[model samples]
Target: MSANIENFPGTPLSQADFDEGKILTTHWKPKLEYGWDAGVAISRYLAELKNGRLIGIKCNRCRRTVVPPRVVCEWCWEPMEAWVYLEDTGTVNTFSICYIRWDATRAKEPQIPAVIEIDGASRGAGILHLLDEVNADDVTIGMKVQAVWKPAEERSGSITDIKYFRPT
Candidate 1:
């Protein structure tokens, strides 16, 4: 059996059609729901955060430890060997002082965000998080800092469990 195909030109609607309610339309409100799995590495990492500890994955091949752990070593392309608990201390590798909130509203005080190189991890492996408890001008590369965790009862298994990093 053969099927027939045809191309048809569209007829433009006129103002009279709209006025007469000839066009058909309906309102719709969709409900969207979903769940996310952080996978093996990140799940363990986040769990450790809630416990007030930092964890990293160690790659035996490259002898590199990475924070916010990954299942594979980025440098050697090998499977990570084991989990390593790291000190909550780190050094500020780089930073920014923003006067605007994440929503783009003006902020009363500047938000200082920085990439902190975990002391026990590889030289450059770091996490991006906010810095607090010090003047914006006082923040600098190589500044020693420590994670200020939320009270144990207030912690949830998330990065926010570590309230922020502050100069030690």
Candidate 2:
């Protein structure tokens, strides 16, 4: 087969064409709605959170307990054995002080986000949550912290049930 490079058709556009609105375009605004069903493991986890407790699943095969309970052990690929109650207390594995809000606006008080390694869970297995009641300058890895839970009446079966973690 012979190539016909010279027969190619269509005009190349320049930046000025788009900038000056030479090209035709359509605009759209879509309204969307959605819902999520937290399955077995997470449903149980959230229920425990609402009741002012932290729960995880234990993998008897690997002898590791994981928070935000999973149905199976990520490492051993075995079914998780039982639900374990984890302490709300943990150590700061890492942290960050943010000057902006989730909406991209400036914040008067910086938010402290951290990975907390829960006491009863396997090392390096933890949750990402906000920190409070401590100076940003004083926040450090290995710092001991405890969950500051919302009042029982305010608990809502969500991670936010624990308002934040703070230095213990």
What local lDDT score does residue 115 receive in model 1, on the 0 to 100 scale?
A: 97
lDDT of 2: 0.93
Evaluate model 1: give its lDDT: 0.92
Residue 90 lDDT in model 2? 99
lDDT score, residue 25, model 2? 65
Worst 10 residues of 2 by lDDT: 1-10
- TM-score winner: 2
* Candidate 1 lDDT, 1-168, residue by residue in tens: 134546456888999888898997677999988788999999999889989899998999989899989999878999996899999999999999999987889999888999999989999999999999999988889999999999989988899999999999
Stretches of candidate 2 off by over 4 Å are 1-25
- Tens digits of per-residue lDDT, candidate 2, 1-34, equal 2475666668899999888999976889987877
